[model samples]
Target: MEFKKFKLIKQMQSTIKKEFIFLLFAAVITSSCRKIFNLPKEKEYLSNNVNFANKILEPVLGRTNLIGGFNGDNSTQPIHFEIVNARYGDGRPVTDIFQKAQTYVWTAAYTGTEKSLAEIEAKRHLEEHPLFEIRSSGEFIMWPSATNDLVTPRPADSTNYPQDTRFFDVKITNTGGERLIRDFQIRPWRERPYDPADDMNLYTGGPAPFPETPYNVLSRNYIRPSRMDNVVGDSTDIDLGNDNYHRNNVLVYIRPFTGGNGHSLRFKVLNKDSVAIDPALFNETEWVRLVHGFNLVKTKEYVQYDVAYPIPLVNLSTIYAPGGSNAYIELKYSRTGFGQQRVTTVLGLNFGIYRAGDWEIVFHFRKDNPRFKDE
Candidate 1:
């Protein structure tokens, strides 16, 4: 019995010794961890004072629009943002804004120097995403795929008023708390397909002239070696009687021409009688480097090119676009007058087309045929 008692005591001592060693090892590890890497305590900044500016968001359909109205105030970094309760102006729920959509995202870098449509398209990949999204950084993005069916546009007339609008609430949250900006107005506008857009009211879709640089087409006459007293400074300056050049004399129209596969662009100039003008007369035009197009075909009637859609593949200055924003088309011809003075008439237009299609731009000189003969 004494020996058994002594054995029990020995077993207890062994267990206690092992437990003490384990405790010591744990303590050493804990102390070393603190000494090796010291980290500051996480901060929780309350967003109670965080607010958004009272501004109406007007996103245009068929284009990507960025929303700006966030005022961080005293909010901390990494605040989360979400669109809550999206609805029409009449309080009807808007389910389309949250639905998944196939959106084109750039998979590879675009330097605006892509040689082919294949090269440009290969850099992009389509992925499913929401039509509208708000980032954690308070940046709101309305995807390009947002159409008229997805959201209501501003009414064009008083009869349609009070019915055409969209509304939503923004929810922002942080570790401190959450905030809701109530009844934020969203007045979406109809799609304006191309940039350098015509003067059109976004709310009413009515004719509204731009205050400055009203038109996109800049057509002017260039007179070299100084102008004579008898010679008119501009084509529009003097009345050519039947051949007068008015601001609206030339009518430019874009129509779909499905001749060159899917992506193609063609230019056609027509006289007052609707007869096709020889494109070769524009001698100063660089046929080879006219645009980012390949497989150029020139004829007496029209100039066709196998081009990548959107004229400029990207929104950067390249040989294709000198301004980096709009596609510029220049047509030029020079003729010597009575005094052997050189008169160069250069017609230029700065414009943009976003939709992908086989398209043709026709310039119709409505009043009279351009004088190409020397006096």
Candidate 2:
């Protein structure tokens, strides 16, 4: 009886061990299957590539305004300037309009040093006779007469207007020889009462303000791209008319008048017309079809680094403009000072335009400073 009981107990123990082994094997197989089947999130994986494109393209084509307008008074009309064309050395058009607009703003804000013709000639002769090249082309003709008499406080009420200030109608044509036209309405800087505490200052406040003037500089028009129909792609058939392509993600560094200080800046990005392509379309199986249908430039990555923060992931999108399509992206950034103070120096805006494929740097500086200079 004892021998039989021992054998039975041993058999039961063997059965339990076999069941444990089977359960362990099942768990391992389940885990392995999960690992094989799990797919990565699409947007996350592609987001890095998108960001890489932005970093590469932002400085090249992303930091200036294409068109901007400023109105000093509500009773009077605002002054407007448009950028007609901007391009790179390789002849490919830099399509961001915002960069062109910021360039105009920087030009308007510049204040040049006054000198006699003899002094100018002396400096020109001494300063290595800089090659005279029209960095940009087309007409920058001023609109509206410079001597238009507008509303102002009476002389007895205010001694501000010693003489009627001039307003010039200006146009900038063929910016950088890309065959485009930019127009501007230039006027003398008029000083009006400005209170920092006023809510109306956000739009048309100081230096020139109406009763509605607020505490800050009133923004006349938000920077934007042109809606003209002809702006399509890189094709020659699109008639590169007086209308120019605009982009707004280029960064500029400029020197201020009073502080002798410099600031780094970028414009805002507003409108983009390209669709984000899915990465799945580039599957190996679809390679033959992709090659047959689209002119596929192997997907490249663009990246950018933020100057502030713990350095989080900065994502950016790339719009593919077919050979002849008007392709552009806009990005806006305010000026930053060393101490984080918003410097009121208006003249410190600068812009550089470059191509996306090439890694070159194109710097566009203001030729003349309108506000401080009498010329």
Candidate 3:
């Protein structure tokens, strides 16, 4: 028994020597790696004179809008922000801007690759949110359900559109210190979401004149019928309509058809004869990833979606609206033409419908059917 005890002690000593040698080798390797890499220590950043470039904010009501123009010069990441002294245009103290209401919030990450309603619901949740909020990144946000006419007076009449304003100060802070940006102006406008004219007049709440751009290809009446001409052996000879056809064309608008049973949006297309067009023909469109909707239902008549209200839940540009602040839907198809050449055409629109309902947007080809035949 004593011999066995001595043997056990020797075995322990051997094990300890091996472990000590391994640890020493590991320490040397780590030190050498650190020295060879010449890694610098991370420097802590503090915010310096942070200012917002867009001191004048003009957010429309009834939609989620992010207020940008954060000019944080030499500021650390994730700078904290708080709204201070929120009041009306006349400097009266207000609390409506801070009141909470039901709003949609993302629970999981939306990677824009979700395939079904189950996936979308898993990523989103409804929560109560303030009317206006300042995020930690020194940006402001106006929630979807915010509507305070007292702070932002509505137009008395169509001709009497007003630019009632509100004033507030922002308290910006970081690990370094805090600074107050005083007298920031907010001139809220009524909901004028989406557009062929993307920018609505702040004074008129109507279509604003198109901004000067050499590449502006958009039109207010984009979904109009093609003009017809009687030319033999020409594709333009397809008798869609005369030039005056747009005056009596089929109407395209959004209206509720579900009696407000659920939050739903639908789309439909019709030929010149007022007959439904098969949605499957738009082969180049992404139905699943279209418009951030879920539970897609395609039929002979229309394509429907179970969507949250205000068409676009937020005004920011996303996969649903690549240009941001507008809802864009692009439909495309291709056909084999003469000489076996494939021809492709893309038709798109950027528009918005702010009111929540069981809405359906119809596109009726009143003049002529889209030419799909080969020469």
- TM-scores for all candidates: the values are 0.72, 0.15, 0.64
Q: Please give the ranking of all candidate structures by TM-score, highest first, separated by commas.
A: 1, 3, 2
Ranking by lDDT: 1, 3, 2
List ranges where model 1 is wrong by over 4 Å.
Answer: 1-54, 149-152, 158-162, 195-247, 258-260, 311-313
Best by lDDT: 1
How does model 3 score by TM-score?
Answer: 0.64
Task: Write one digit per residue (lDDT tens) for candidate 1, span 1-375.
Answer: 999999999999999999999999998888778778884445778556676665477787766666766887877777888888887767778776677778677789877667776887899888887888887778777877777776556676533444455678888888767888877766667776555444445555545443344353343321111111222223344522222223445556666776667777888888878999999887777777777777899999999888755656556787668887777777777778769998776666666666667887777766656777776
Candidate 3, lDDT over the whole model: 0.66
**Residue-by-residue lDDT tens digits, candidate 2, 309-341:** 100001112121122112122211223334765
- lDDT score of model 2? 0.24
Q: Which of the two, 2 or 3, has more lDDT?
A: 3
C-alpha lDDT (0 to 100) for residue 1 of candidate 1: 100
The per-model lDDT (C-alpha) reads 0.69, 0.24, 0.66
The 10-residue segment with the lowest total lDDT in model 2: 51-60
Q: Model 1: clashing residue pairs?
A: none
